[model samples]
Target: MSDRVALVWDDAFEAYDFGPQHPLKPIRVVLTVALVRACGLDALPNVSAVIPRSATRAELETIHDPAYIDAVERISREVADPYGNYGWGIGTGDDPAFAGMHDASARVAGASITAADAVWSNTVEHAFNPAGGLHHAMADHASGFCIYNDPAIAIRWLLDHGAARVAYIDVDVHHGDGVQAAFYVDPRVLTVSLHESGHFLFPGTGFPDEVGRGGAEGTKVNVSLPPYTYDDAYRAAFERVVPPLVEAFKPDVLVTQLGCDTHATDPLAHFALTTKTYRYLARALHDLAHSTAGGKWVATGGGGYQIYAVVPRAWTIYFAELAGGSTPTELPAEWVERARAEGARELPDSFDDHGVILPRGRREEVDERAAAAAQETVARVFPYFGLR
Candidate 1:
């Protein structure tokens, strides 16, 4: 079997930028694509760059209200008043309206759909749309810096295209509420999200109790860890919850939101992860894609604000894994210099951040809480999959 991987990207993705001050910067995607080239992953024989087209109004309507789509289109034409609140979750501090908002956001959604089509058609063994994974967009409004809810849109596309089962795994520090909401009452798509507890995060949802509704009960799984959750605990929770459920679900395709914001250095959320966690996650997800989903995987990028130091490196690792390649531990000199020229201040010299240890007392407290949360999540949802 060929390990062909499609990198769904277009330079127009930079048009999705919110503003100079927004925490969600386009520089992260820019740096990630640059590092992919710098690491020579783009030059591999099995890897190919695939430029994507914009999502059409009909496609966007599959996951968004037409009124909301119209609102975004109308808002995209005018110069945004930073303080203006045009409703439909636009022009707010989180999802500020800018010119070309609809075009850029629709392009992201279209990119994820392109990845899904490629994987389903067997054109590639896997596909990664690094500019995609705006998982926080709602049918009627946007939230959490997401405008199009690309993962959900792509999942719906898969279902429409004869895929009976699709599994979505989200590891961002924020709950994948929008994706969960999209399929909460449908059994064909299983949505699993592991993130910091809603008590401490934005959108404030994704508890163990938020299982799927009606016939889809037990299909929507959430492992909400406490703040300060570390690499081991998070990975353990993922292992205990995600793999078992995915195996049981037996999805026809696997989709992932590879958000690297759980890194300790991130400015938005609280989790003590290092690049090691991302590396582990990439390897594990890659293995699962082959084992359970017949090697059909569609991956996307999401929340990671540590643009200079973390997001690029973490996502570069993911793309390498998807392409059946490995990255050298030493950071390339030219790439480091480029990041520095782009205003990077505290760059690491290698691909990995060995991470930091918390004080013993704090470590023990956080460990215990995270373990309990993971155990509780397992105990709550395991019965649904017939696992003890």
Candidate 2:
């Protein structure tokens, strides 16, 4: 197998637009890829750009209901859903009906699935799909600006192909409720998420008690952090949950939802992480993939609304690390100028926003709260894996 990583990209992925005003903008992915090129990630010897094929109906049916799939297609074709009562979570405010919604969403899912295929087939040790990672779409409904649950479908693909232990780590601000629900009772898939507390976040439901059911206990781990948690606390919380669980599970393949909305500048949620924090997390996950899963890692992009300021910068560095390259202290000047010429807001001069997070105090309190959440998760979950 090659040490190269697959880079899944396509221009059509921009069609996943909810609208001009929706927080989940596709331009973020575009800017990310641009920065990847600007920083010479695309020219790396170990990185391969791949144009993915859209997933088929049968492929999607593995996780989505056929009727719901049909509803997505219908809404994509018609201006309005012919069956308004379908209740498939389409045509709503968050996920409104749009042209080519199903095709675009399935394409994103396919890009992710293709990355998974490469890693599983040993064609590549690692892969990335910056347009994928719609973690909030449920079995029969779309939520949180997501259409099809691509990461869940890819994990299902892995399970069907004889991988006994598949581990998923979601670092998005919102709970990865859709992916968790998909494999909550399946012992073969371990889904771990670190997010803002459900009490304070949207689509909120990733608590310590959701540690899978029956045979799958300990397979679902959640570290719900406080709203204002900064880089050190966030990293500490992530380490407290993810490393131990993944080491214990010893998965066949590790899939991650790399959502960058945890930054303090992000509009949707309240996390004080900077670009430096994103780099640390990505490098840690890369090391864990090699240490735990023999380097079989498939990562995808998720929720990041700070398109100009946060998403592009964070993900560009992340892609560089995943491609086995080093990130620069300062962003390429050409990309910053391009962003400015395009009228981007808060065009960062360097990868680090250099923002201070803890001037308001309460670091100890936040750390204690996060530590308690991790302990509760271990108390409820670790015994299933014969730990603690």
Scored by lDDT, the top model is: 1
How much is 136 displaced in model 2, in angstroms? 0.6
Q: Every model's Cα RMSD, please?
A: 1.1, 1.9
User: Model 1 lDDT vs. the true structure?
Assistant: 0.91
Worst 10 residues of 1 by lDDT: 76-85
Can you tell me which runs of candidate 1 are displaced by over 4 Å? Answer: none
Compute the lDDT of residue 138 as modeled in candidate 1.
95
Please report the candidate that would top TM-score against the real structure: 1
Return the TM-score for candidate 2, rounded to 2 decimals. Answer: 0.96
lDDT of each: 0.91, 0.86
Candidate 1, position 165, lDDT: 97
lDDT of each residue in 218-335, candidate 2, tens digit only: 7998888888888888888778778888999999999999998988888889888887688888889998899999999999999998888888888877787788786678888888
Which stretches of candidate 2 lie above 4 Å from their native place? 80-86
lDDT of 2: 0.86
